[model samples]
Target: MHNYTIAELVKGLQSKQFSSVELTQHFLARIRQFNDQYNAVITVTEDQALQVAQLADQRLATGSAPALCGVPLLHKDIFCTKGVRTSCGSKMLDNFIPPYNATVVENFEQTGAVMLGKTNMDEFAMGSSNETSFYGPVKNPWATDCVPGGSSGGSAAAVAGRLAPGATATDTGGSIRQPAALCGISGLKPTYGRVSRWGMIAFASSLDQAGPMARTAEDCALLLNCMASFDDKDSTCVDREVPDYSASLNKPVKGLRIGIPKEYFSEGLHPGTEAAVKKALTDLEAQGVELVEISLPNSDLSVPAYYVIAPAEASANLSRFDGVKYGYRCENPKDLQDMYCRTRSEGFGEEVQRRILIGTYCLSAGYYDAYYGKAQQVRQLIEQDFVKAFADVDLIVGPTCPSPAFKFGAKGDDPVAMYLEDIYTIATNLAGLPGMSVPCGMVEGKPVGLQIIGNYFDEARMLNLAHQFQQVTDWHTQAPEGIL
Candidate 1:
């Protein structure tokens, strides 16, 4: 059961090969057995999951169940799961249980997917590595000493470790895709506004978008079918018809032109990862995909621009967490001023504080024009670069991360090095385009991900390309040795 992909699990449940209760129990047991090795899950709702599974079994009997009925999945701690501690891997909100579910959680609930637990994340989704998580770092299943990418690292680890078949993760500058690359799984980041963001704890308001993480592209497509919808409550959500993402996943890839950016293959990329991406491209070419070399010259400026824009928004969004609010509050403060300063200083982790400080400074009146305004202009240049390249390409492909999973603390001392881990991924978010990561090959015993970026509202096409590639490769089928 643990080895089954989400597509297989759906079939088994529909055919009554196993009851949802039994399936839920199987996953709960797996989490208990394997989660300690990775620190992937922060909380387990064993009783709630079993109860939900029982209801799903009843619906299955009626033959009117939804696509995800009885499926068990994890939610990144950043999403508000009503009645569950929605800790964003920060001590500040450690005791906060959202009174209402995040729009993403509600959608999954409506589809009858049982929530087994909430996974850990970087404090307020602020770090590149899971080390900033208050719950502790998530160990890469491929190498226990290596760090799984973050702040979706726990969700990535949980799925990679086979504790769950899929999970819900958000990408604010590559959180979902980077971890998926390092942990060896399939993950997607839908176009901004394609998925509702209401109740999802804001990191960088403009860059944050939720999507699916699973073992196979087909599974991610199925999950996305349930996760996406237009909600009036989320002002950012686009009003568009929700397509069945799994419906077109078997589409032919011939005649499709994919762009390869010169910047992606430049210095700093690991040789093994480059070799793996090239091999994957060759395989795609054999399937008749036209590869075209293109230039995204502004790609070099993405890191600097993202750091400015993302932190600026984060500073404004996180201001609601002052001591007087619902989260952590300082005790026995001398005055209101003391309470405000002490509560924030003590509650937030070092990484979160660093980002907050940077954000505040960037948004300050004196530096606003030089930093934030200039970054916005650079962001526009990045978006224009993608727009120009897309004229001749159906999609853009590259290494999801510059390298495979690295030993914990390898880049901890250098913020710039850690920020560069997302070099190939941040542009898509800046451009509001859909992007996904699929395991391409192994590098030093760890996995490398091939990223596919598509035009806005073109997720079905992206998933189709990924599913077709998966049909020819076994990389996504492989799991960490000795971990299982």
Candidate 2:
């Protein structure tokens, strides 16, 4: 039951092979046994999960259950879960519980899915590695010493460890994909506005887009069916009709033009990762998917531009967490100003403060035009590069990260090196395009992800291609030793 995917679990529940309660308990027990090693889960929510499972069983028996009726999943902790502690891996929100659910959480409840727990992440979704999490870093299930990619590392680790079949995660510059790549799973980042962001606890408003992480593309498709919905509560949510994402899973991929960016195969990319990605491309080419060598002229500038834009947005979004509001407040402050300064300084982790300072500097009155304004302009050029590439290609393909999972503290001390971990993925967020990472192969026993980028609202097609690739490869099915 623990090894089964969401689609498989759904069928088993519908056939009465196992009750929802039984399935929920099976995963909960796994969490208790394995969580100490991985540090993937933040809160257990055992009582609440079993209660939800009981309701699902009742619905299943009455034949009124939705497609994913009895499925269990973990939220990224970035999403507010009403009474559940919605800590964004930061001490500031460690004791704060939201009174309302994030739109994604509400969507899962509507599908009758049981919430298992909340997963750890980079503090305020700021770090490239999960090391910055206030609860302690989430270790990679594959190699305990290696770091799971951030800020959705917890969700990716949980799914890879078989603690959950799928989990909800947000990607603002590869949080979902990088972790998925490192942990050997499937993760997606939908186009900005394709999924509602209300109650998601903003990291970088313009870059943050919620999606799913799971064992297979098929499972991700099933989860996405419940997650993608327009909500009036979120002004950024698009007013577009949601499609049956699973409907196109079996679609043929012959003659699909896949653009391989020349810039992606540069000096920075690890040879092992590059070799694995090329092998995956070879497999796709054999299936009649045309590979075209293309160039994203502005790709080199993505990292600098993203650091400016994302931090600027983050500075504004996180400003609400001052001691005056409900969050972590200083015990004793000499004055109002002292409270604000002490609260933020003590509550926020080092990485968060670093980003906030950078963001503040970028958005300062004197530097706004030279920094933030220019970065936005550079961002438009990056988007234009993608727009032009997509004219001749159906999708873009590349290594999700420049390298496979790195050892803990390998690049932690160097902020620039840490930021470059997301070099290949930040552009998609900047352009507001949908992207996904599928397990392709392993590099030094760590998994490499082949990133698939599609045009705006082309999630279905991207899933289709991923599903087709997965059908012929067994990479996605391979789990970490002792996981099963």
Q: What are the lDDT scores of the predictions, listed in order? A: 0.94, 0.95
Per-candidate count of clashing residue pairs (backbone under 3 Å): 0, 0
Q: Which stretches in model 2 have alpha-carbon errors above 4 Å?
A: none
Specify the poorest-scoring 10-residue window by lDDT in model 1: 475-484
Q: Residue 441 CA error for candidate 1 (Å)?
A: 0.5
> TM-score per candidate, in order?
0.99, 0.99
lDDT of 2 by residue, 88-200 (tens): 99999989999999999999998899999999999999887899999999999999999999999999999999999999999999999999999999999999999999999
TM-score between candidate 1 and the true structure? 0.99
**Candidate 1 residue runs with Cα over 4 Å from true position:** none
**Which clashing pairs does model 1 show?**
none
> Which RMSD does model 1 reach against the true structure?
0.7
lDDT of 1 at 456: 85
